[model samples]
Target: MTTNAPRHIISLLMENEAGALSRVAGLFSARGYNIESLTVAATEDPTLSRMTIVTSGSEAVIEQIIKQLNKLIDVVKVLDLNDGKFIERELMLVKVKATGAFREEMKRMCDIFRGRIIDVADGSFTIELTGSGTKLDAFIESLDKAAILETVRTGASGIGRGDRILKV
Candidate 1:
């Protein structure tokens, strides 16, 4: 994962106002940076929104992103979760078509991976899995022999391990 570039996995907290996400995304796109995955949701404090962003660039570019993001009017907080103590998780919904031997094997695989079989029909099964990104990838890779119809992922989201906030 080392490309001599700055790969930042950051989380931002902001007001649940309109256009705020757009503004932040626009800032990155305008600068030609890449957003590997972005996930946002309303926080426990109902008035706030949380955004998890994964992007990479040279060290200088990351510093620039930190500075520019702070300048955005609606960005209330910025957290560098790559700081190494956060608990991260992602949700993935995978649909795979199963027939004959694949049907029994698919169920077995799901059990082995601790994934839930959300739906099952004569020819397909929709499964749901939640865990760290790497675990999810491993699950998906092992299911490659089955007929994969579609997959929708919620991207990585997390918080600090303890009661402390990313911002005190």
Candidate 2:
């Protein structure tokens, strides 16, 4: 029986150092698996950084990715959060061109979506929004008529739902 592949959110705990992220990217590039989203930041401990990556692939390919990551010298741990109950969030910064009609309309949409206008200019405003990808899509769609989308950046982070914590 053939099964449709599912998207997976994988997080990695790795020692903070140069080229670590590049190495991981090299693996994916060589294998030609697209990375949908990637986020990395230093942990509170200062010695480690957390990497959250979203990808789509077959179960076998996913296992291969995990195994390849384990072989990296700087990798400390890898956790597949998709299989577990987890809370996922993504941050997006969007700059939109604004005017009279679209400005108020855009503001209304932002207010409804719980997004905040971070910066304002004579004819434009930069908005800061945080939510899942789907939510971001909706927010962007609402502003599509007014916003030309000068720039955008997105980062994904996830924590296990309930009391479950990914231990080091």
Candidate 3:
């Protein structure tokens, strides 16, 4: 309920079929647990999909969530990335005002964040950046709040580092 609650990144493998995602999401909603972010995509296995769910709760709460997820009919496997060493990333596309004096400053800010100006318009520039959620947030914070026009973020996706792998 609060930001101080420990955040958890739960990765799950499930059947790549209609309603699988809905069921997963529904479970969280039904339990009144808020999902901070969720990213789902078909994995290399045609029959399976990988879903990364970001949520915050106490250790007990996270344990309960994982147990409930494992009981789902569609879920094949589940792993909490926080349980071990892992790498996480999120993608953000931000459109900012790029006119007059703002243009140079915006470009400089983007370069500092290692972001790419993927699109340019008469008065706006769209930037693409990839990194951990904190990094993305820092990039946004570095900008003038009024300069931000629109932003889209792909929720955090993560995997265990090294030999740790979640496979069917």
Candidate 4:
């Protein structure tokens, strides 16, 4: 397997309105840069939105991406979480087969991972989990591949660890 590239978590504050997100996405697409994951939502300030994007590249490529983002009209500020201490978390909802012998094992695994069974049917269980991306990946790896029916993930959301803050 190929070794993973260095990943960077980029957080930005931008105007909260139609087309803003599209513009940011377009910038990456135009440059042939791949965005591993992206999440955006309106912040407490109605006029602003917080977006978190995960990508991997060399130092020079990352710097260029940041510079280009800063030039966008809707972008107010950009912060690279890797530059300092930051806390990151992602949310995932996974639905898996939970019948026969698999049911008990699935429940046990969820308990071990601190995941909550949010929904249950006769043959399936939907679990809600929140943690670092690595933790989430481990949870998936622990399960039987064929057992996983569906999964929804909210990309990594991050913030500086302490008094450091990103604001316009």
Candidate 5:
């Protein structure tokens, strides 16, 4: 990761309808920008959706991205979490080989990371963990690479800290 190129967590409140997500994604694709991770779901207001996008770029580039996002018709509100104190988290479900001795080791690893063993089968265990991206990455790194069978992650979801709230 390049420290000079800052990573930004952008949150958006938009119309919950078809093409809304496409337009948001298209804006980045058309400009040749890459989205590191994205997660979207309907908000408390069924008519609105909340989207969290993680991207990295220079200061000017991040400003441009925010500007462009604000111009979209379906976008009701846009917030750059990095602009203020915020809390960010991600959830990951990983399946690892757990046969024989590996089972005991994997269980110990999950306990050490405070991860929950959500599922178990004859040869594997599925664990659920939630935390900052770095902590999640570290947990994965701590395990043997070959022991990992599959993984799924919910991209970063963030909200402003303290009394700051983004609302239309």
Candidate 6:
């Protein structure tokens, strides 16, 4: 069935052992599903790691993916944040040309976006910004494409709202 499907952020608490991440990624590859973004990091508990995966599919496809994830040996829990209220953020560090007129304009733009100029060079300024993917994209869009020198982004990391926590 063809229908417009929205993106989903699925968070998982899994064993921090080696190869555990590959197994989860393998499942998606074997099924030909696409993962837009993925972030995995060790949690406060040394034994577990939190992984956030972003993907899009129809309702039935997403349901199947969740079921398959729960069956993984390393995956202890999986929560589709879209099922409830959640907060998501992504980090971006962008380096832009800042010389003469562009320098003041760049500083103004960064301030307007609430980003920090983490690094300043004679001809470049590296700005760090954390926000939703859309906000990060907007920041980039607001600048002159030629002014941008480099950009690095950490994919989306998300968590449930109050009373909804993903933990061991």
**Which candidate has the highest lDDT of all?**
3
Model 1 global lDDT (CA atoms, 0 to 1): 0.84
- The numbered model that scores best in TM-score is 3
Q: Each candidate: how many clashes?
A: 1, 0, 0, 0, 0, 0
In candidate 2, residue 95 scores what lDDT? Answer: 81
lDDT of 3 by residue, 60-165 (tens): 8899999999999999999999999999999999999999999999999999899999999999999999999999999988888999999999999999999999
Pairs that collide, model 2: none
Per-residue lDDT tens digits of candidate 6, residues 1-168? 233478999999999999999999999999877798999999999899999998989888899999999999999999999999999999999999999999999999999999999999999999999999999999999999999999999999999999999877
lDDT of 2 by residue, 1-168 (tens): 123467888899998899988988888899777688888889987888889988878888888888888898999998888778988889888788878887897788778989899999888878888988889888877667536666575667888888767657
TM-scores for all predictions: 0.90, 0.90, 0.97, 0.96, 0.96, 0.96
Better of 2 and 4 by TM-score: 4
Taking the tens digit of each residue's C-alpha lDDT, what string does model 1 give over 19-61?
9889999998898777878999888887889999888877677
Q: By how many angstroms RMSD does model 5 differ from the true structure?
A: 1.6
State in Å the error of residue 98, model 3: 0.4
Model 1 clashing residue pairs (backbone): 6-57
Candidate 1 vs candidate 3: which has greater TM-score?
Answer: 3
Q: Decide which is better by lDDT, 5 or 6.
A: 6
**Candidate that beats the other on lDDT, 4 or 5, i.e. the better one:** 4
Which residue pairs overlap in candidate 5's backbone?
none
Best-to-worst ranking by TM-score: 3, 6, 4, 5, 2, 1
Q: Alpha carbon lDDT of residue 120, candidate 6?
A: 96
lDDT agreement of model 5 with the native? 0.93
Per-model CA lDDT versus the true structure: 0.84, 0.82, 0.96, 0.94, 0.93, 0.94
Ranking by lDDT: 3, 6, 4, 5, 1, 2
Q: Residue by residue across 1-168, what tens digits does model 4's lDDT show?
A: 112768999999999989999999999999977698999999999999999999888888889999999999999999999999999999999999999999999999999999999999999999999999999999999999999999999989999988879987
